[model samples]
Target: MDEWLDQLANTLATTTLREIHSVLKRAIRQAQARDMVLRNVAALVTSPTGTDGRPSKALTRQQAEAVLKAAEVSELHAYVVISLTTGVRTEEARALRWDHVVAWIPSLKTWHPVTEVGFKHRKFAIHVWRADREGGDTKTRKSRRTLELPKLAAQALRQHHTRQAVLKLKAGEAWQDHQLVFCTSVGTPLNASNVRRAFRKITKRAGLGTAWSPRELRHSFVSIMSDQGVPIETIADLVGHAGTSVTEAVYRHQLRPVITKGAHTMNTIFGDSHHG
Candidate 1:
């Protein structure tokens, strides 16, 4: 079975391999907890093949605009905007509530909620916990950091609130106060798959190319910031990455332009013949 699994891992694309690795890691951890194993064997394992597989893609601005326009009529349109604009993961967006989001229009600032998440899984499944919105914490300690959204993202959220209120009035007694910024028809927590499906449909309708996904929206946000010359240190803080190193390791290829510009700046500043 181990050999077969190894072969399976080798055959998987990068994203799929990551998912498999995550599941294996979780099972290994559970076995360790049960005294079935002293160490996690999967943790000892390494990917020999590397990421010579399908790379993750970020959405183009035009594609993002189309998606935003298509989702305009969706009840959760604001949530989509916030996720895409701020680079917060879907789980982070889903976990947000009215209390968590603070809009200070006078200051032209919006603060994202920060909270700790305690869990036992090696890779906390974003989907399962999403099914029961109250079940898990944020994905990581780094993920507990706060972010300030740009003015546009905050405005979208405000409009979404007014729209949500209308839906609540329509649902009347059936509206459950789940405190979620994004909810189902009757205010229950939305199924993560359903939300993804809806977004995919919206993208298709808007003629966004095949590169968009819930996660890609986040990638796009980071990429846009990078293009705008936001420092990796600041980007790390904005997106809840542990450090600039982690951000670069994960997104270097996507931020190649930023990297090039940084190199150019260094060359310009220090390349001249001055004090030997």
Candidate 2:
């Protein structure tokens, strides 16, 4: 005989009230998109106290180590390695080619390649050499960034190249010329889903739980860098963020300690100890 929500809200716990409010808000937003609702009724309600809902969980360093160790013999190990170490997007790592590695001096350094891009050299390499390899567009103009590869990441790439060469020999003419760093048996671009499936298999076998995903690897990268006290601006630049503000907004929770540490550093630098 009475309004159901009014009856329920009168009897509902604070947490239940907040959740009901959230569900209604989402519904209203969807309805608003179709012009069925003029305003979000849930938005008008005051949120109940002390009910922020479930927190997101991320991998601890130990879990990451376990995953990487379990993935050791997999052909896709380099993908995990690059993701964990350098925060390179899965597509960018897959899209990488042998030519992307620039040798310092042609005759001297046989297998050694550096990734630091100088203005003149990048221009020359992009125009003359890298154009030959297919699959070159970065996700965004900002994503065309050059990051210094960690030592292990570079080593993994070297091993992957050798492995691919052997694969090419076995496949013979059947191997398509994808020039991709990661590929299927016949040298084709890997669909993102397939990689995730393989990744899940390895993680499950390793007992890492079903919660792990490729995006978690990227999140791990940000967390590790954040813990190391890397500046937000520098981290943003390394990770191809458009600006420090974006990085701060997205990673604010992860960077809280870094922010606190930065404040301390600034205070120490400007404090009376420095004023002779």
Candidate 3:
């Protein structure tokens, strides 16, 4: 198996190798969960890092704006808004529950469920604590993070809440209460295919055609952040990678080696000495 795996490591691109490793690992974990295996031996193996593979596509800033504009009439509007702005994985977005949407109370200096407290002028955040994965954990420990919602996303969620309430009334007794942030009109959990089909429709409407995937929204997020001169390390944290190596390796093209945090920190400490 080691020799075969080594040969695969040599033959496959890095992204493909890592993805294969992940698939094998998750398969074993599920087997263990089902009591078919004693342990997840796949967890013991390190994911192979290889050279580049077929790189994924990301929407440019203009293209991303177009998608959002097109999503305005779609039920998936809030889903797309949050995914692109926060770089949340598709699974994470789908698994997001109402309880995790929180709002800060400046006067009380505490957080409350936005479902209960409602959105005001105060800051709001999403506790990225769960996913649709087995055992309901994020892909990695670092992937479990809290992020403040952008103003656009916050507004979308508020509007989405109103819209969902209307759906509940329309659904009547047929509605199921999974408390998911994103769900079907009948309140059933969303599957990948459903999201993909809806996303394609929105993309086609945006004049981007139907080939784009929902995951590309995440890639667009990383690209957009990198283009904004955010340090790779910060992008790594925001995207929930344990370190910057994956972010650097995966997004090398999107990261244009612009002014980094290193320069900003130095300038802050040195009073912009070079400018004089």
Best by TM-score: 3
Predicted structure 1: clash tally: 0
* RMSD to the hidden true structure, all candidates: 8.5, 9.9, 6.0
C-alpha lDDT of all candidate models, in order = 0.69, 0.67, 0.87
Query: Model 1 scores what on Cα lDDT?
Result: 0.69
What stretches of model 2 exceed 4 Å from their correct place?
Answer: 1-57, 106-143, 262-276
| Residues 1-276, model 2: lDDT tens digits | 125455665666667776777777887998999999888777776755443434334456887788888888888797898788877666666666655654344445332333343222211111011122234442444346666566666666667767888999999999998666688889998888888888887688678776567766767788878777677788887766778888777666656465367778788889767756
Tens digits of per-residue lDDT, candidate 3, 118-211, equal 8775688998854435566535554569889999999999999999999999999999999999999899999899999999999999999998
Measured with C-alpha atoms, the lDDT of residue 180 in candidate 1 is: 77
TM-score of 2: 0.62
Clashing pairs in 3: none
- Candidate 1 on 1-276: residue-level lDDT in tens? 356556776667656666777678888999999999999988776643434666667766777788889888876588788888878878777767666664333343433232132211122111112222234453544335555556666667667767788989999999999877788878888788887788877788788744456877788888888877788888887777657888888887667455468779888998866646
TM-scores for every candidate against the unseen true structure: 0.70, 0.62, 0.75
Q: Name the TM-score of candidate 3.
A: 0.75
lDDT of 1 at 87: 82
